[model samples]
Target: MRTREFLLQELHDLSQGIQGPFPYDDLRKMRETKRLTSHFKMLGDDDQLSADLNTYFMAIHGLASRLLTGNAEDAPTTAIHWLARGDFFAIFPMYCFLEDEWEQFPQFAHMYGSTKKMQEIVLSLLLTEDEL
Candidate 1:
């Protein structure tokens, strides 16, 4: 799928009690930020950074795919733990993802200013929903 489609599906899948065909507006809101695009660009252009990040993203996506395809146990927790313990430069996108949603999500504000905690919370929250 296209990146935008993936993100929109991810948001819908991860949110609890959100009834809908899908919230295109919210997806647009999240995607409109230049900050997110910048990180994606960086991930694409920097070889070393891109290699590491690709691995991380693949791991995360594997968990997500498993969750969506009937492997619920492989949730975001493992990926989150991996991120918290790995190279700090590798997790910049996740940090930006949490920062993007934190202001609008007060409960997630607890994760603010701490990258490790934020990464954990982001994974936990994403994996908390009943539906994948």
Candidate 2:
């Protein structure tokens, strides 16, 4: 498994390119997609996991909407806030891993040691984002 430091470093690297908030509509579509919800459900059978998943999705949607409609000056701050609170940074890599496209992004393959670890990270982020 990759060390936690490696994951943190990758996140830091990725964050450098984030200049503003993501499009609210795009995030909403991603969050509401049936495939993603089904994948989350398939990750676990527990109610806590399901609830966390829903809460996380809603949080992202809310954040995105707020940023989209709020002051332009607040975009960076809002983006950073949501980015820190959620696992949006890890989503694309996890999706690639789930879809067996890790080979297309060799760097992300080191983000998590295994598929199980990736799923756990996803769940953990979802459960914790609301707390932040």
Clashes of each: 0, 0
1-132: candidate 1 lDDT, tens digit per residue: 235346435533543222233233433443456655565445454434334534654554455455455564646665656755543444554444434453563322222223233333345445433422
Highest-lDDT candidate? 1
By summed lDDT, the worst window of 10 consecutive residues in model 2 runs over: 107-116
The local distance difference test score of each candidate is 0.44, 0.39
On TM-score, the leading prediction is 1
Q: Mark the 10 consecutive residues where model 1 has the least summed lDDT.
A: 107-116
lDDT of 1 at 34: 61
> Each candidate's root-mean-square deviation in Å?
12.1, 12.4
Q: Which stretches of candidate 2 lie over 4 Å from their true place?
A: 1-46, 71-132
lDDT of 2 by residue, 29-115 (tens): 433566555654554544243244344444444433333344323434443354454353353333432454323333333322232
Model 1 local distance difference test score: 0.44
